[model samples]
Target: MNKNKKVIEVKNLKKYFNVGPGLTLKAVDDLNFYIYEGETLGLVGESGCGKSTTGRTMIRLYDATAGEVLFEGKDVHKMSRAEHKDFTRHAQMIFQDPYASLNPRMTVGDIIGEGIDIHRIMGGKERMERIYNLLETVGLNREHASRFPHEFSGGQRQRIGIARALAIEPKFIVCDEPISALDVSIQAQVVNLLIELQRDMKLTYLFIAHDLSMVKHISDRVAVMYLGTMVELASSTELYDKPLHPYTQALLSAIPIPDPNIERSRQRVLLEGDVPSPINPSAGCRFKGRCRYAKDVCHQQMPELREVGPDHFVACHIV
Candidate 1:
């Protein structure tokens, strides 16, 4: 996994949106993590947990409200014009919705080659050849290059989005729920393709999604987020086998098992309360409101994410 080489490092990152008068939405708050070179770090959480926001802010798609995102030891938000351009070429994003992400007017070839042209990487026959190669690499053909996004199915459209991201030959990619919009049957296909591409291209990924099972399949490590705060982080196997935080435990318990007997015998950890709003949130653990083991301290102080076991971290007082 090349743990010694960090492809991306996020430190105390925050992204807040001012929604109305005297109101701010903390989309991503106090995030801290790192993506190793040539490894996938899966980010799993419920909707509106800031998983996408974290990915976006890390890549500088949205400017941070606080803290830094270091890309190969360089602060991403502090880069110069030329450096930002180079960063764009080195890092790319694959949006969640294939239908909305791709330009409807542009053909597959043009969409994939846009980055190449913008970066002036190549032109003429070589450019066309690269486009053709990318198309074939993503399981499309040269003939499909002339077709618009509407001509392809959902999965096929996503493959095109992948090709577009790959066209720049990026070292890191923010896969913002890239397979969420696809059919259940097709989701695995897309994830498998991503795994294959990462291995072949030597790419690192921050793969954000709500599907824990899929995340486990594709990720070396997984981080669990709740109310824009990280509750737990660990190796995929470790997190699934022995989750420490209450929120993480509840989240892992919800993943249905294939065996009927095991599923029937297992007890689900049902969270009682609704998730608290992130707008000017209280000074305490975000999950304490719903946590069964919440103590007096949990309501007063936000527990920092601490390493308890080998490569396993959790943010909870009871842990």
Candidate 2:
């Protein structure tokens, strides 16, 4: 978490999908941030807000249209084939849908051992042993390795997915809404496993999720995104306790409190309209249409992310 060392640094990263010659969808636009070594940087936003796109772009699943992504101070996009394969071993992703991500035809043993085989890191007996250990680490029995995806529950399948990711001994992982498809009770278990594994392995994480409560619990810092742009970034406690941006304040106001007295006392700050379309977005702030305090300047000019406090940044005219 030290400022001096960044495992992954993203500078003005952009990802756009081409719909046609004159049309494009800006999924991630001008995002600038860095993930400190061995820390979880929680990326929270509404669906289609580009959180997933940002993660995918960083891993090169979708080639970024602009900006630079550096891993350990090396440019990720410029890596050679051999270096790319090495990069894959160090950086792995646990996708949101466990059932869809895992192969239905492959046994759990094969699923976990696939990375080892591709990397040529181990032989037959050692690879099988590692797969068994991974299954055990994720709270699944060794015998279950012979079973298919359908044999496991939603939570168990997720554990299998996690086992696969960990099989490669990755130093960093992008958890793309990993628990969004699981039951509420099961979510905690998966989250706890990630936290524990991170501690044991000293791993860094780009945890992209919509669950603010879970994000608050798991993240060392949180980045708030709106309509493909990052609006605010700050320490988890600072962001939750004293949000500076109007958009951030509005978002936090919507989270429900358990206590009846506190819940009744709180007033929800609803935005005025839906998120603006990203395809050739209007010049100005992406949130200009719904920002409560947007002024004339907000509609005509875009705001840059500027530091407001130590390790705290916000982008908005009102901020």
Candidate 3:
């Protein structure tokens, strides 16, 4: 956790789906980023902008149409059976929906111990002990292990999901909007638990969420995506203070400030036009339609992400 090591690296990652005989939907296109060991990299964008899809693709939930995902310097998609099993053991996911992700039929202990049994980590008393320990680790108790998922509240269900992900002792986890489905009162509790767990366990995370404020609170580095492509990436503090991309600026402007006077004085960047379709997208910049400062070049050529400031990268012709 103290060392600066990369846990995951993505290079020119593209995931496309064929909707019809001639139409193709680009869910993730040429995305390039890396997550350091013990650090949280936040991926934020509007819905359907491929935030969740990117997380799923990185974890091999969906096959890539092109490009490579390197987990600990090994290609995730190209791994053999043994390597894939090892990768699965080291990497786990906490899905967005707590209610849907957990199996209704299985007991809490069985659900949490499923990975332990699949990998044959332990059995009998030892395995039962492990399940009980996992439950306690996520703020639950052994008593809850005998119950089903329907018996728990939304926040408790998410905690159970967290326990399930940690059962195998994974190094990297894709937290795909883990707290999005929780009640507003319970959201902070879950986020705080995740933060504490990361500090205690020395875990790395790819936190994907549309909640920019929450992302800033948890992530070290933030990557902003728009229309299946990365628009900007920088340290959380730097990106929040000085965003370079139009989409990013608009997104930040939408966050409500606490002070009434300051909020009223602040200028909101209201974007014009609807988001362009990702299906068979045009040859130019995907954000050009909504960007007021877009020029002729933005319509003719797609912008590639370029380093603008120290550790700050942005993909925009004007920037």
Candidate 4:
């Protein structure tokens, strides 16, 4: 991997929602990360931990409340109309729910060709031919192009989503839990397809998921998030083998081992207490409430992500 080539750089990116008159939800709080070109950077966290929100905010689907998202050194939220349209063509997203993402009223061909039409890439026979090729590229036939999203199965619909994202030939894609809604049997197939496509197209991806085991298989580097803060980040193998943060250790311990003997002998690290609310969160280490090794310092200051060993980073005062 080329360390100097950065496709997306997120510096203190934050997204908050005004829930009510006085209430605000801190969905993503001061997130900082980078996605290198031709690499799949996995963002793994529990539900409601701002994984999807981060992805949406990165692509400018939602306006960030604070900080900046730099797509190849350009401010994503401050782009001109033409520049924003160009960014859309370069960066695309595949949503989590295949059933809800695709338009039921539109046929498969129209859905895939939507970006092509908006970009004025082609017209007439050329557009039709492009759609047909995309259909076949995603393991679908030409005949399936005429059918609506309602007719396809969950896996087929996800394949359609993939085709649609690829239609404009995007260099970057935010895969927001793309296989979460699919059947367990078909999840591997979809993941394998993405892997093959990434290899062939030299695509850069920010793959978000809650499943740590799955992330280990597909990601070159993994970032572990809790509540709305990142706890640990490192290469997939290193993070699993030597996690520095207490939250990271607990999350890794939850993943069931394939070997029966090892699984039976291994001790599970279970976290206590409920996750604290993100709305106007108090100043302190977010994991201190559930962490077993919390100290007085942890409850007083919010630890910034610090480099401990090589590329591994941890946000824990005790560590």
lDDT (10s digit) by residue, model 1, range 1-319: 7979999999999999999998999998898999899999999999989999999999898999999999999999999999999999999999999999999999899999999999999999999999999999998889998899999999999999999999999999999999999999999889999999999999999999999999999999999999899999999999999998888889989999999999999999998967788898888888878988989999899999899999999989998
Q: On residues 1-319, what C-alpha lDDT tens digit does candidate 3 reach at each position? A: 5447899999999999999999999999999999999999999999999999999999999999999999999999999999999999999999999999999999999999999999999999999999999999889989999999999999999999999999999999999999999998899999999999999999999999999999999999999999999999999999999999999999999999989999989899998877788999999899988999999999999999999999999999999
What lDDT score is found at residue 227 in candidate 3? 90
Candidate lDDT (C-alpha), each? 0.94, 0.93, 0.95, 0.92
Give the alpha carbon lDDT tens digit for every residue of 1-319 in model 4: 5678999999999899998898888888889989899889999988898999999999999999999999999999999999999999999999999999998899999999999999999999999999999898889999998899999999999999999999999999999999889888999999999999999898899999988888998999999888888889899989989998988998889999899999999999999988888887877998888999999998999999999999999999988
Which pairs of residues have clashing backbones in candidate 1?
Answer: none
Clashing pairs in 2: none
Error of 3 at 128 (Å): 1.1
Off by over 4 Å in 2: none
**TM-score for each prediction?**
0.99, 0.98, 0.98, 0.98
Instruction: Give the better candidate number (3 or 4) by lDDT.
Output: 3
User: How many collisions per candidate?
Assistant: 0, 0, 0, 0
Candidate 4's C-alpha runs over 4 A off are none
**Model 2 RMSD, rounded to 1 decimal:** 0.9
Identify the runs in model 3 with alpha carbons over 4 angstroms from their true place: 1-3
Global lDDT for candidate 4? 0.92
> Over the stretch 1-319, how does candidate 2's per-residue lDDT look in tens digits?
5567899999999999998899999999999999998999999998899999999999999898999999998888889999999999999999999879999999999999999999999988888999999999999999998988899999999999999999999988999999999999999999999999999988899999999999999999999999899999999999999999888888899899999999998999988878878898989998988987889999998999999999999998887
lDDT score of model 3?
A: 0.95
Which structure is stronger by lDDT: 2 or 3? Answer: 3
